[model samples]
Target: MAYLYYGADARPAEIPDHVLAHVKVVAATKLRRGESFMLTWRHRGEGTGGRTSLWMQPSIPLRFVFDEPEPEALDSEYLRKLANEATSSRGIVLEWDDEAIVGHPGEAPPIDAMAA
Candidate 1:
């Protein structure tokens, strides 16, 4: 499965509902705005011998996926909720590094690189 990483905070599971909603909104807005950007993150862990962490950031091209597109109207309440969520998220600001290995499914490639 493909994964989306939010680097600023580095706590994926701790994202609040409001922030998630805002992310969806931001993604949708970016798609509408014709803006595509790369998000990167790092993974750290300890193996049998020692501790290690790798900085592997991937660049992804995101397109708007609309089953039923909504009108280009921004809901104030929703926007506020999203803003609050983003504030709470406090995600880290990561520099863009376009060096990620794409991974594919149904074929076992390297255990590290994932299909884009």
Candidate 2:
């Protein structure tokens, strides 16, 4: 699993590839536009049993990791669907921690940004 963080904060986990693509696009767009927002995710578990986490940070200064590096761009329609979902609901989000995180896990942890 991979973890996606906004700025220096953890967002979501176990995120689907498609949704992750959308999130990247959205986050990139926001960064390009000089905007930022809160990002959150379920770092562990599934559904009601999940333990959620959040982080607050800028949109552009983000890091993405995988078993392999992800492509820069993704399908537009799929990304649009994710954006729609985010707009419709809270979407997969992150919980904020007062302490700052400046790096990602060296190994792939069972925590993906979009999988949740």
Query: Best-fitting candidate, measured by TM-score?
Result: 2
Query: Which lDDT tens digits does candidate 1 get at residues 8-102?
Result: 53434222232223345645544355544332224323453322222322333332222334323333444443334333433222211233222
Q: Estimate each model's TM-score.
A: 0.27, 0.47
Find the 10 residues in a row with the least total lDDT in model 2.
Answer: 100-109
Global lDDT scores for all candidate models: 0.32, 0.46
Candidate 1 residue 54 C-alpha distance from true site, Å: 16
Shift of residue 30 alpha carbon in model 2, Å? 1.1
> Could you tally the backbone clashes for each prediction?
7, 26
**Candidate 2 residue spans exceeding 4 A from truth:** 6-14, 46-48, 51-61, 70-73, 84-116
Every candidate's CA RMSD = 16.2, 11.3
